[model samples]
Target: MRPKIYLYGDSITEESFGDGGWGASLSHHFSRTVDVVLRGYSGYNTRWALKVAERIFPPVESGGVPPLAVTVFFGANDACLPDRYSAFQNVPLHEYKQNLHSIISFFKKRWPEIVILLITPPPIDEDARLRHPYIENPSGLPERTNEAAGAYAQACISVAKECGCPVVDLWIKMQECPDWKQAYLSDGLHLTQAGNRIVFEEVVKKLKEQGISVENLPVDLPLIANIDPQDPLKAFQDY
Candidate 1:
């Protein structure tokens, strides 16, 4: 059976299978070698994800192939300002950190050999958020801010180090580009194709560091190139 790679997070992850999305890129990158499973919930926070973690990834004893790796990508919603329209999604920073610790612990308990890759929330563009408000904002303020997202990103990285897991510090990586607000983010929060590409590259690079590269993983079945046209059934005989 092909080893699986799980993507667990909120809206960013929910949209990760869309055209030019990072998740789709990973699927293509590891084609036939692994299954990239997504467990994403739009508009969810760590608190909510923690609540549903077991449901999404039940104990391996429950009868499913355990994943080789899991990417935890969340925090955008959790950084929303308490006074904003999206305040309902906001989780206090300390609690957010705790939730991440718990989430990682849950996965470790369920799959002791699992490789966890933590992804920090990408930086936001307040100007773009104002232009693309989720609702008409009478206050004319963006529900989220780059500073808040940075804080969350830091918290995420801290958690990864504490838990001894690999991490993709996306917020810092994206900002390394001079025009990241326009090049990487679509609506200040969601990612553009360029942004997705950055994520794809970073994820592949990080996974490679953990010795989970495509070159290291075996293809699930015989290569079609090796099949004889006259005896195609030979491939299936052993399959």
Candidate 2:
């Protein structure tokens, strides 16, 4: 069976398979070698992720194969202001860190050999949030702030270090651009096509570091190059 890579997170991850999305890019890059599974939950925070962890990531059977790798990307919603309309998604800083640790532990316990990667939340753009607010912006203010998001991003990094897992510091990386607010982020919170590319590149780099790259993995079946023009049927016979 082809090995699998799981993308587990919130809306950012949930929309990662759309046009010009990072997940789609990964799928294309690793085509014929591995299966990239999408298990993102829209509007979910770390707190909610913990609640639904078991249901989404069930244990592997005694003899079943576990996923080759998993990416945990959350914290955008968790950084929402406690007093804002999106307060329902706000998880305190301390709890947010603990929740991330727990999530990693859950995956490690189930798949001892799995390569877990943590992705920090992208930076926020308050002006964009005001320009394109959610349908129910009761407070008429940005529910999230870049500063708050940065704090959560730091927490995510700390958790990754504590658990000895690789991490994608998206928050800091995205801000390296001068116009990140408009170029990288679609809304104040979500990612744009350019932003998705950044994610795809970073993820590929991290996976490669852990020895899970396309070049390292075997293709599922015989390559076309191996088939002879006069005896193409011979190639699949032995497969």
lDDT of 1 by residue, 1-239 (tens): 78899999998998999999999999999998999998889999999999999888866655667889999998999999888989999999999999999999999998899999999999999999999998898888899999999999999999999999999999999999999999999999999999999999999999999999989999888889988899998888975
Candidate 1 Cα outliers beyond 4 Å, as residue runs: 61-64, 228-232
| Error in Å for residue 35 of model 2 | 0.8
lDDT of 1 at 23: 94
Relative to the true structure, how large is the alpha-carbon lDDT of every model?
Answer: 0.93, 0.93
TM-score of 2: 0.97
Question: What does the lDDT come to for candidate 1?
Answer: 0.93
Q: What's the TM-score of each model vs. the native?
A: 0.95, 0.97
- Cα distance off (Å), candidate 1, residue 130: 0.4
* Clashing residue pairs in candidate 1 (N, C-alpha, C atoms within 3 angstroms): none
